[model samples]
Target: MKINGFRGRLITADHADYDTARAVWNGAVDRRPRLIARCGGSADVAAAVRFARDHDLEIAVRGGGHNVAGTAVCEDGIVIDLSAMRAVRVDPAGRTARVQGGALWGDVDHTTQAHALATTGGIVSHTGVAGLTLGGGIGFLMRAHGLTVDNLLAAEVVTAEGDVVRASADEHPDLFWALRGGGGNFGVVSSFRFALHPVGPTVLAGPIFWAADDTTEVLRFYRDFAAEAPDELGTVVRLGTVPPLPAIPAELHWRPAVAVICCYAGAVDDGERAVRALRRFGTPLVDLLAPTRYAAFQAATDDTVLHGWHYYWKSTNLAGLSDDTIAVITDHAYAARSPRSYSAMFHMGGAVARVPQDATAYAGREVAHNIIIDGVWLPAESGKHAAAETAWARRFLQALQPHRATGVYVNFLDSDDDTGRVREAYGDRTYRRLAEVKAKYDPDNAFHHNKNIGPG
Candidate 1:
């Protein structure tokens, strides 16, 4: 608390906000940091890092606190909390935005939408920008623009030695490359500079759902249509019960279904035409596809996956949806212990697939989709409910393993994941390169709390 050069508030066990400060997005993670350093800027972050090193205390860096893995908080370490620094500055002229470490996708979307400029971000608006970008962020705009890291111009990082440095294409190029999809093993990202693209004030976006019996037909159509769909049209398939929302038909609320969530980043009229075939393909239970404010559409699923829920997630990359794979997922989709839980598949192509695999540490550039099975349960529905709910996700993932590609998405993994899972995220080549970068920056492994890539 008395460390010099650290000009930020520190919360201890006895502090009034200690309990709230330690909470993460996943209610399952209950950790108590010995000290929570509410960082105001890079200086505070650096000082906190140095203070932890000097005291032989472990360090956990908190940025948006939405990793679900709960690496944001440590059992008895120092948490360099960046929640207080949620400033976003947009440069419309340069087509870029500078975001603080703790800023969420909603913060970025709201600011960038004001200029009709945006970047690829998380599907869930409240997801952390830092964590998502580092793990190759994918969303509705990914096919149109690219992964969040593809647009990442630079980052200001606080290294293990407490040095503040900038990583970019021209400066610390290797570090910049690693930060793109290497997860947060390097350091605490104080701020990020991202290249933005012209998106929309209004875009054609929403979900179209079909009845449970139509899962096979809808999924096959989704696979075919997505494969040939234009880059401007982004698509995702969710096989689960419908979320109860105002925009949805009350008659179809909580009904088991297969749905296509669409987003077109171009002119609304063009978007309408682009997805007309999909909208008319089936006897839909509910079709909410229409022109919507871009930022609002980005947050469409916010309530369904709200914070403070006990969350379990497992996911993998795939070349495409095989019939066997489809059958396996559909069989388990509606059987989730929690009605709110779902199995999801995100279409990956366009700008995402065009990038070379070796271009960045992100390993899934060649894959066609990313499949995620999420088990969600509320606090009151935890205990035995949590175990049963998570078992569903685990089994769902296992059943589809034979159909999955070589690697997993590092971002989807939780704290309990073994080192093999981390290695599986990036293959031998990328993993070795990341380990070398980690050795040069954080040999002592002070930042090992995350989905770690250790020192070589």
Candidate 2:
């Protein structure tokens, strides 16, 4: 159990914190690893990679451990837990942030916002920067600043063979290309340097909710509004119940409703003008949109999708939000079995679509929206409720199959999703290209724990 030169906390089965070490963010995942290496930095990560390879143990790289698939901790394998390595250094003069792979979106935002600089990050502040970026991150800033992957300037990685290297446009360029959207199939990224832009200390943003019965009309309006909205106007449509919070009317607590979560990264005056039509939309149960601190709003709704929840998700890249597609989504939302379960549609386009289709490993540039059918519940309702939850997510996906775009986001893939689904995440050509890069960097497929692009 001794890992030579591994200068980090190594937790074994007998370790006092073994149970805690193996636990990831998803309550549905109950994996027991033979070794949990709490990496201190790149050297520790390299040592763990070498140890895992020498022992023929599967390697699960854990950043934020928020991956719904629970691939962050493998049963009877080695987990390269990077949670302790969170360190963010901002270069305000250069407009860049060099962050450790373990850092969460909140860490990056906290540091970068001090200098009034930011980059695209996942909706939840607790989500890992590495996993989200590697799989083509979609977030509030995406419409204006592009995806997190698009902002990724460089990465420091530990290869499958235990070699430390840097990947960027000028060094290990091929590996850098794959790192953008190729997931974790190639290497374990120890750190990332991202291109940052002037964001805000505060921006106009929040949620507006309507009764579930008005979802149809809301969808139609959103489809048109989103299509024409300026790049600064980013939006997310959610069909779910209102959380029982004081900000909302007490009577509306836990009531089925549809919401438009809006963030405008522009002048407050212009943003006011931009969202005026939406503010006037059919009788809303509540309208909370207002000028808010950017970093604060990023985690505002985290309570709804908290850690340790029993999470199962099925997602797709939609070709467009046509009337038929909206109908299918509304039907599933109404028929959803669990009150905790809901459907979400993320608006895609603007800076994300402007990127060339073949520019990075991410190939969903033309997709107008990314939809997810999320099945969530508490552990107390876990055992028998799994079947119904699983069925609902699967059936929801099947209903949207015909309207799906060319590729699904790899980050959204579930733990049991098959290799065919992985291929679908990347088109045949991009997947093949990624495999070539995989073969060059990780010929043995040591990092197959992710949405893998197997080495050819």
For all predicted structures, in order, the TM-scores are 0.98, 0.98
Candidate 1: misplaced stretches above 4 Å? none
lDDT (Cα, 0-100) at 70 in candidate 2? 91
Taking every candidate in turn, the Cα RMSD to the unseen true structure, in Å, is 1.0, 1.0
Off by over 4 Å in 2: none
Candidate lDDT (C-alpha), each? 0.90, 0.91
Worst 10 residues of 1 by lDDT: 411-420
Backbone clashes, candidate 2 = 0
